[model samples]
Target: MQLEIISRLPSTKSTKPPILCIHGAYNRAWCWDKYFLPYFAQAGYPAYALSLRGHGNSAGANRLYWASLADYVHDVAQVSQNLAQPPILIGHSMGGMIVQKYWEAHHSHPAAILMASVPPCGLWSPSIYLACQDPELLWQLNLIQFFGLRFVTPSLLKKALFSEPTTAEIIQNYLAQLQPESQRVILDMLWLDLPTLHSQPTSPLLVLGAANDKVFPQFLVNWTAKIYDTQAHIFPNMAHTMMLEPAWQKVADYILSWLQERKL
Candidate 1:
């Protein structure tokens, strides 16, 4: 399968392992291009982001709705295999869950970072949490899943993604790039496909979350960290889409520091 792999390299090559970023549902590799790819690369780490099958410029759009979580995992594996060296995986939201499954299968990555990722228990807890905490946002997201961008508005999109003030223009730009994600993959995350905790990877792990994240709340982030036996870091006043927020550099810098400390 043809995949879109967007890359950025530092002017002076370093021995740092390449960083492969995985985007979440409704987003593609371009989501990382705006901030993460360049930021990581500038810090002397080669950075790349892949548009999962049916997302961004990747192939299989016609079969997107039928794509399963396993298919997404395979896509990650395929990209990882072709890299010159094993990559340090960084995943956001649903993409974080994909990283977990990929690590479970291979267990060879240098490290893994989960940013506002779905919990290993799956989406049930967060789904129920959203239903109770902010039913309107949940309803709006459901509408977008079946109805697409027409159901999204600047205010609602901001509520779901950004806790910091963001201009309507930026919100609209992201809206234009948004696309329908696979229903099959959604179901897989909901119940069918989840990480196997019996054998965990020994690679260093970083679990990050936003205090204002409505989708995957701080509790879920804590749960994910607990399952992985690591501490969770919840940034104050941030939301689900940290990479696109006004304070995106804060998140990027934190990750860079973590990587440097581990010397990965």
Candidate 2:
């Protein structure tokens, strides 16, 4: 199982900050394309997005059997340790959770941003089902994963996760990028040991939430940050797919600003 890293560094010495973007469960590294990688690169921060083992072009590892979450964390660890400077670690959904685990294991100066993704508390609680604001969503979840002929349909996952704040084309594009089993494995990790991961200390954390998101509830994002004594910013116009939100560039701005503030 070879790791496929979309490593992008700045061309000029002046653009020296490095950022590592990690995507969520059931998703490939391309999820960051709508925002993180390119935006951060333009912000004078070089960025890298890696397709975890069993994900995207990185699949083919037997080690990815849902137990690979730790391996995913180590992926970040390896990059973080080897980088000349501690990179700004930004994760969406499962990627955010992995960043947390990495910080817990390393305790370094790397900053982190969680955008409409996972928080200190991983999704799966009854509250999230309620926050989904869709009464029949839970029922549909099981049906899609098992019964539906189009089990891996991006349209369905997009509908379950996004609240119409993202465009159909964007959803379709992202769906095309997914490597299914990798997505399943990471979600399973969130369900099992999320609380322990949440207990770990984090650096200047930014919890970005989409008020309209159907998957990760706004309350969970807010609460997760506060519980860890960090700050959060909510976007009423965004959906669960914060990276694909119409004004996804706004997310990039906020993150770059946060990184700047930390430097100040």
Candidate 3:
């Protein structure tokens, strides 16, 4: 339940609520601290990133393999409970699925941002596509997460996460920071723990995707947006890890603009 916060309160104490960023599988709050947290904070809105129960510096690292998707939801809910008010939830990949589940259980947020997220349907489509097109990449991912080792080569990492302009040094640093995720969460994504599509929340949703994202392509992002009756803004020449990409500032700027337009 630990949080990494970047606070920049205005002299008069602005009325804007903070943003809570939730990281995806194999990642932690540090993912947001790298760019989004500071960028948003500099824009006059406090931002926070949460380390789920077993990820990063949070507790329950030893119990990761046995932790269920519900456990992840509880982690998010607990963090929400501690906030002054329900913060705008910005979730990435598996974290997006967690946000969806959180909404189903308790729809209490100003808005939600789903970035390169897993679709509500499930992980089956993406898994099958990767297995067919690049089985080796999928195999390496499994090796890294399930076996608690890093098996990803630089080429594969670039193919799956980054775009052409990304430097090798950035890729190396990010790869080094990658951690193992819960096996139960992986299994749940494939089948058991998909989000509830029936009771979808009507909160303002901003769905953003990258054109070059090999994991969740534009089509998948559009599908999620369509379900919520919105259009997706696809960033060109970017990949799955858009937030950490070289042009991350553009993404942050767009989100800031959207928040202003919606008055959230």
**Per model, how many backbone clashes are there?**
0, 4, 0
lDDT of 1 by residue, 1-264 (tens): 999999999989688899999999999998899888999999999999999999999999999999998999999999999988999999999999999888767878999999999899888899899999988888889998887778877788888988758767778888888888999988989889888788767999999999999999998999899999999999998899989988899999999999989988
Candidates' C-alpha lDDT: 0.91, 0.69, 0.83
How high is each candidate's TM-score? 0.98, 0.86, 0.94
Give the per-residue lDDT of model 3 (tens digit) for 1-264: 554333334345556877988889888777788788877877777677888877777888889888887898888888878877788999999988888888888777899999999988778888787788789887777777766755667787888899999999888877787777888888888889887678658788899999988888788899999987889999998899988898999999999999999987
Candidate order (lDDT)? 1, 3, 2
Clashes of 3: 0
- Distance from true position, residue 125, model 2, in Å? 1.7
Candidate 2 structure quality by residue, lDDT tens digits, 55-162: 777855565545456778877777676777877788887787787677667777567777766655565553356545675666665554445325656666666666
Worst 10 residues of 3 by lDDT: 3-12
Model 3 lDDT, residue 114, Cα: 91
TM-score result, candidate 3: 0.94
The model with the greatest TM-score is: 1
Off by over 4 Å in 2: 59-63, 126-128, 144-149, 152-155, 163-165, 182-191, 197-202
